[model samples]
Target: MSSSRTARWILAAVAAAGAYAPAWAAELPDRTPGLWETRALIDGRYRVVRRCFKQGERSAFIDAVGVGACSASAQKTIFGGWMMQADCRTPKALLSGKLLVSGDFGAELQGRVVTSVTPAAGGPVVKRTAMTFSSRRLGECATTPRG
Candidate 1:
């Protein structure tokens, strides 16, 4: 094929991908991080939680300590990287300031909620939520645009 023809083919492929971009963007996940801190509402006031984690890392010894379960969403740049927002709540909701991750299987933005205003002893255990952003090299959250 001629060079011009090859270039046209590449451009066409890119355009096709852009059309369904939003759905794909929403499906992607965030990267993992070494340490993270965020604000929270406690007794009608706000506080922060800072944590340390590693990929494929879990502790059975601390099962009694309690760990939170959370969820997240992501936004994609024209390039391959992403910005993700994770929520770990009683009702569960997204938060401000998204964590960024690479195109390589976003595992950074994860969350959980383990506490609740209501106790399980009354009936069932209600849980509180917490957001965990396992991310790219701490500061790799920022990236350049593809366009």
Candidate 2:
């Protein structure tokens, strides 16, 4: 085989491997059941909030990225974390983004999501938004009895 033919075959094989890899998409472990304090930074502004997760609950950070009509394009494990890519459609815009998450779910977690949005009826303009967040488990949540 000529050098170019051999190179093309190699590239094809790599592409085929990637095509099937998403079938085993790696997932981040669920957050621990308890209260968590989450701090987020967006556009140089900071906000903190607390939330409680029940047993087998997904991380709030993960939920934030899945808002609106989204179809996950890819997921994989990387750098002691999981990375997810998706495209989403909302009433006003179409967005594409990636979320990167890391840290042990038992005690602390860190994540960042960056998305680019295009107006549904716009020309070639795109708006980009990003948020960086970190959460620490803050013991158990207080239980409220239902009357």
Candidate 3:
């Protein structure tokens, strides 16, 4: 898959894991709202991305997780964290994966996800990839986008 597509898949998995939080915890963990930098290890390569979190957007992250064209199940809390299995279908491929996240979500957060993607056609081959990521708050957002 292309680099952009891979990044999106990893982000989606992370978001889904965050979504799994509500099923196990009554309230969402507090996170610093501002510029956050995330570094992900995909296929042995490191990629860093940044996102600006506006006020109230943090809460939306909880509700937005796993709310798209995906189905998630087998959610459980483990060792002060959350885990779940999920499957997502796109026009080009079907992705099934397991997501695990650990942290208080206040200042630091970490997660790991493994997914297998099967193409709609081409061949019967399935590609498997694993991604590990961590995010740290970087003070206030540099530029807040208009909503």
Q: What is the lDDT of residue 82 in candidate 1?
A: 46
C-alpha lDDT score of every prediction, in listed order: 0.31, 0.57, 0.65
TM-score-based ranking: 3, 2, 1
- Expressed as tens digits, the lDDT of each residue in 25-116 for candidate 1 is 35543225344333333234334434343453222212321234234343455345544343323222211123333334322322211222
Top candidate, metric lDDT: 3
- Which of the two, 2 or 3, has more TM-score? 3
49-76: candidate 3 lDDT, tens digit per residue: 7776665454333343344646656676
The deviation in Å at residue 119 for candidate 2 is 1.9
lDDT of 2 by residue, 4-57 (tens): 322222222111111112233345465678888777675566666677768865
Residue runs of model 3 more than 4 Å from their true location after superposition: 15-31, 55-68, 120-125, 143-147
Q: lDDT order of candidates, best first?
A: 3, 2, 1
Quantify how close model 1 is to the true structure by its C-alpha RMSD in Å: 19.8
In candidate 2, the residue pairs with backbone N, CA or C atoms under 3 Å apart (3 or more residues apart, or in different chains) clash, namely: none
